[model samples]
Target: MFPLLRVFLSDLRRHPVGTLLPGVALAVGLACVVSSVLVGGAYDTAIQRNKPHTPAGSAVVIRAPGTDLPASLVTEVQQLTGVATAQPRQVTSGQVLGADGRPLNTPASIRVEPSDPRLSTTTILQGRLPRGDQEVAIDEVDAQRKHPLGSSVLIADYRTGKPVKALIVGVSAQDLGRPGGIAMVAAPAFATAHLDSTTIYGMDVVLTAGTPVDAMLPRIEATVGGNYQVETAAQARASEQPSPIGISSTLFVMFSLLAMATAVLVAGAAFRAVTASRVRRTALLRALGASRPPLVVVTVLEAVVIGVVAAGLAVGSGWFISVGMLSVLNSVGVSALLGSTGVTPAVPGLVLATVAVALGVAAAVTAALRPAIQASGVPPVAALSAVPDAPVERGAGVARLVLGAGIVLLAGLLAMLGIAARSFFPLLASAVFTMIGLFGVLGPLVVPLLVRVPGWIAGLVARFLGPAGAVIRVAAREPSRTPRRAAAVAMPLAGAFSLLAFGVVGSASLRDAVVRHSDAANTAAFDTATLLGWGLLGLSVLAAVSGVVATTAVSITERRRELALSRALGVTRTGVGLQVVAEAMLLSVVTAVTGSLIGYLYGVAIVSMLNLPTAVGPPLPLLASLAAVTVLAVLAAAGPAIRGALLTPTNALADN
Candidate 1:
């Protein structure tokens, strides 16, 4: 055991480059999964924790028919049996103008109540409840600026076309984080402002402890006569299942799984490549009478070591990243529903389980299987011989073209239909198909083209860097020699990047379209800026990961003997590695720039098709996007280049 452990560590140290690449990939994938789950779960938990504060048991919220329950519903529900007390509350959202005339509207919550003990549950942070119709209780967070305690605030009722000057009588901590602009005032004041009490957004029910909510629910429904939606605290909380958040969570999980699966494939391919490259070493061990069992065990041990280290690093990094992201989200008012941006790390069980199931077993099995079998079966002589180039399948070329054409057609059809229908799902579906088709059809042709750009750049650098640059050219020039293998490495990266780019562009366009339509329909009703920000953020994350994967794969490919030879001839490893990194960075930069341009055009086209106004100018987000892609390109290159530098001449030249 000790001998094997020592051998494992020694091997990792010796071939740090090879061992580290996969570990890094694994770590990245693991971090994404862990961070997503932790943040998502925390949001879920926060929503649950906050639901109980809506109202006491048996107290129901009431509103006008087909409208959000009005504050008056609290009174109607209080009249029911087994109900302790009902507080009539009217919630309205609108811009509050400061003295400077700037709009102070940011998803505020307003609750109008008749100052009574029945509504005393509303906790006041400072000052007393409103004594008159002209006074209102403001959320503490909302009162921070020019609207301090006892300050005059202008509440603009867009529906009424008037701004009401109201005195700030009290500030409540409980009201601080309510979604939309929340202000507590006397019900008459809300009525005076023409905020209709007939329409209730939601009703909270406070029932007696011994009373069964189920029996009272139907009766309460009967009392409201379908004019309002009534639910007990338990029912309301249950009903507020965070459907949108749930969908996002599911998407995050699915993407994480896909990333993990990609990591597994990458790990497996890397293992095979390493094993094939190390045939001589395996043959030498066999010549020394190393048994098949011991050989297999050693291979398995290597994978386990790599997997454990990667998982450990990933888990820690992921947790920190998630915490930090949550903090940012909170600070930026993105997740204002969440009072605190703090993320409670999910159960260690979830983290460990993800590592074990997705990364651990998959990596170990992938790394060990091929090596174990080949090491056990291949004769010592064949093992020592150079790897024979496998013949290319002629059919694959035709297949690539055919598949590519089919995918393009399918995506085009979907996009057309989506544009015609003005449906986002169709557009999203089109984007997915387009990405798949693009990689399938254009991978062979496009990757070679993409590879050449880097090759040329590397050659130019070779003028200054010399040998290392030459090695980059050599490896890149014959990309077709291992076209399938090269594509295997490049396709995943391309797919990921294409999807990310397309998704970002598509989502932005969709949001803009939705905003325009909403503005036309009812400008005062909805705001799409928040949605747009979230969509862009998600796409940025996707693009970053894709860039990382692509650059890493290219770096690994550049470290072969051909590369070593270049290094041997006085070219520094850093220079050679730099050439490879440069190529990848260049490809990504081109893709990002091209994709953004195309996406913007596509968005305009869709808007035109919808018969909506295409008068909007170029999106402001594109500049930020370009910056993000540039940063990602630089960061992604670091890992692979470091690996390329560590490749030893003897090891790289041995097989050649």
Candidate 2:
């Protein structure tokens, strides 16, 4: 056990990047999950904060700006058994002015309330809360930003588009910061201007403690019947979490799961490669009297260690990631309809950190499972034999290829029929087949072919690498000879990259379908689609790219002897590192490109089948996705590449 502990520490110290690469990849994915949740929290908080608050005791705030209820409806609803207080107001938009009289619309809110703190959440900071028909109170943020206390404001009636003037007498604050301005005014002033009985905005209902909203909702609706809506505070937060885009929260959980799956696949591939490459070492360790199960446990432990480290980094990174995502959403101008809530990273709790770690461990375990089995299953003599003791069966390989092709053909047939008839279900079936069948079937065959690309690239790089080029170029070509191992490693990379491509294309297709197929307005459909696409895009890239790096590192790890020999023969460490990096990157690009093509065709087919106008040409996002994956792949490869380059000849060559 002491020897085992020493070896574990020694391996980590010696191969920091290789040992940590999977963890880093998992970290990126976990970071995305954490940041997304945080961003959503920030957005939800902002919605609750930035919007007009219900009076302090209010349990539910319902607004019907479109179908304004008569003021009489609130009087009846207030008489309900569970109701403590009901406040009614008229809602309208106002173009507020600064002391300098310009269009100041940054801060936004609904409901111009009266000067009572018990009914609303406004904190007066300057002068007094507005009490008269000619006065109003502006948000303190906007007051400081431009329209200060005592500034003249112009209110535009939404129905008639008429402007009315009023003075901002006081400054007020909302618990959550609003990006747009919130203003308050005397209730009489709002009523005097908009006297139409149908123009009553809505009512805020506050239930007594222990009175459930659902219970109170029916009674209130019974009082102020027809066209009225009831919503609890929890519902309000959920509805406003991501404005305009009505994607299900379940989908977000699914996206996070998808990211974890990607991490697991990548980690698994990398671990498998590592295990296969270490067969000789494992054999020696067993010969030295170590039991097979302990060695396997130790091997699995490496992945667990990686998971722990990855989770820690991911927790810290999540905040920045969330902030950046929200900023980007805001920049595109579809973050929300009326307001673009500025997001802060959600405050992380112990639960959030624990979830991240658990996810990491899950991924590590998934990755370690196959490799651990492989390492323990083999006899030490068999393990010490040449890399693979037996020849690959050509008949089995051919049979697999045929089965995969058959499935692909069936998928194509399904897609064509679906497109011809304008049916989405069959098209969906086709996508399932295309993704599962193509990757499952063709990945191995293509991997050997793709492996040659890096070998050719090594020739070009050899010029730059000088002495190291020959060594790398030779090593790069070696994968072509071992089709079985190459294919095994390549399948995960292929599947991961393909999924990345599919997610991007599918999001766009779904958006187009929603716009054309549903009654949702074009603006709304597009906004929803755009947000959804971007959200899924992050998950796809992080998961796939990380998987590629992990797989490549594992594969290249087998070359430790070659790397050590190259170093002893006078190749520079930088050159060796560059070779390893190039190999991983080239492999990723080739597979990603292949996957992208399949994904694009599937996206087009899906959109067409949904009876929507098929988007023409490739979108910039698809291209951007490719570039992003490539860059991430490079980053993931860095550690393993450097470790490989740093291998010493004496230690590596003496392994046999």
Candidate 3:
């Protein structure tokens, strides 16, 4: 172990950048997951904090269904045994008028602000609370949109079937747990406007010291009778808190998992290229009688170091990412709807940081293990003489082929079942299996076939060009020859595109139907989901871009000897540059196309299961983004290619 550690240290010292690049890719993914968790937690916490709080001791709620409670009920609740104070919660339904003189169309709960501050749930965020009978306090969220301070708000009174004009004297913070806005007016305002036929709607009963909430619940229920709903403060709070299994939380968790998977693919591809570059070094060690076990140990040890370094880097950057994400959410009004706007992201604790580091290390090691094993198994003589970027196998092995086929079949079955049964679990399971079967298991076999499409196009275009045409054709063929490398580069791109297409198409299909059929609460939830989908798409794009750059750069670096040999054989510097650009662009474009199609199908299947309208047209903007990413990859490849091409053939050969 000590000897292997020495070897690992030596290798790491020699190739620090190569070791760190893969780790950096892993770090991006780890950081994304960590930041997402923090953001989600912050959202939950902000929501809870923004809600109306009960007094310090145990509290009971008495809710009368359909009709407002009589004034006698509030007095009866206050006089009940163990009840210290009973505050009546008087609320009526209304709509706030927009600047255009029409109702805002969004429903709101109009609440009476009592003179006693202890009984009031309203927290003034701007100006002063409503004092005059004709003045009111609009929710901060609504004020930002239309009714600012000093603005006149017209309320559509349901009981009178007429609009009541009131001056907005103040703005109060909105409750995050509840949907829509709350409009607050003083107690006299309710009677003056005749908003509701009855005054008292419900009561908040604070129990006395040492009072058991469980014992009080039965007593309150008996006194209030069967029509009223009785609940403890804890239960009421729980109801207001966002569900753990809600759409937003679910989306965050799912995206985090996907981000980790993407990191693994990216880091693995980088490890493969880095290890390939050290073929001669490995051969020299093997020739000196170093066994395979020692070689594997040394490689794994290096991976461990890479993992730890990546984890540290990722953990450090997580907080900034969380803050930025929260800011974006607030700007888009998602935070305003779900919780408080401008709320700080919850700080991740020591335990969370430790877990993030562990995940980073695990992701890095998982990515490197396969490549390390393959690198160590190379025979000394072959490693000494072989090209650095030579293919390990021409095609997928029989075992892999069988396994991939079985998995694909399982995916098809799951997808069909999901559609037939209208089940989300089966559909989600199918999506997972689809990526695993097509990309993870059968990538080598599939990528080569996909490569041929671009190769054929390059071949035809080469005839139209002069010397550069030959380079283009040769570059296109390079990915096909080394199927594993091509597959690794393609995997992240395909997965990202799939998700992109899903988000784009799914949102389009569901938007109109959801707005038409669902109430404001349901519509708000749907909108939030759409916004969260965009966030996921951003993460996927980051992973995709990183994967492309890392793989393309490594591919060019690995072929230093090949490029030098071509230069020796009289290929111009211009030709070599074109070759580099062609390689990156072709691989990126093909994978992007493949991924989009897969993702579109997945979207359609899910939409069909939900019985929603299926969007027909493809997402053009997302497709354009594929081209944009290809250009970015080409730019990355061009730098290394031009730099290497500047070297004299003799110098390049010597360096290789």
Best by TM-score: 3
TM-scores of all predicted structures: 0.69, 0.74, 0.85
Instruction: Give the Å shift of residue 150 in candidate 3.
Output: 5.2
lDDT of 1 by residue, 388-499 (tens): 3222212237767887888889889988898778776777677667656654456556555656765688777777857666656654654444344444444444444444
In terms of TM-score, which candidate is stronger, 2 or 3?
A: 3
Model 1 spans > 4 angstroms off: 1-17, 42-54, 57-86, 92-109, 114-135, 144-273, 282-308, 331-333, 336-380, 386-434, 437-446, 453-475, 481-485, 500-564, 567-578, 583-656
RMSD of each: 6.6, 6.6, 4.0
Task: Return the top candidate by lDDT.
Answer: 3
TM-score of 3: 0.85
CA error at residue 322 for candidate 3, angstroms: 3.5
- Residue-level lDDT of model 2, residues 1-656, one tens digit each, is 56876787897899787667667557877887777667656555544555554455567766674566776778777877888778775544355544454555443443456666666545465677676666777655456545677777765553565555767887665433323345444455554564223246656787887998877777776676567776775665466444532233344556766676666666665676666666666676777778867877787787778888888888888877767777876655444432333445556889889988888887787778777877766566755565432322122277888888898899989988987888888887887787667555665565656657656776877778676656556646645544544444445445555555655666655665665666544546376556655566567466667665666666556666667877898878887787667666666677668767776677677766555565543466667766876787678668877887777878777745
C-alpha lDDT of residue 137 in model 2: 72
lDDT of 3 by residue, 1-656 (tens): 57657766775698677657777678878788877777877776665555565533438877777777887888888898888888877655666665555777677766666645555666667777676657787777677777789988777665655677788887776754345555454454554565654356577888888988888889888888898888887787677666654455556767877777877888888888777767777776778778888787777767777878877777778779989988888887787666356767667778878887788778877888888888887677865574554444456789989999999999999998998888878988898798888887898888877767756676777777756666656776777666777788788878888888887778878876877888877787787767767776667566666776676666666777778888899878887777877787777778888888988888888887787888744565576677677777787677766865775667666733
Identify the superior model by TM-score, candidate 1 or candidate 3.
3
As for TM-score, the candidate ahead, 1 or 2, is: 2
The weakest ten consecutive residues by lDDT in model 2 span 387-396
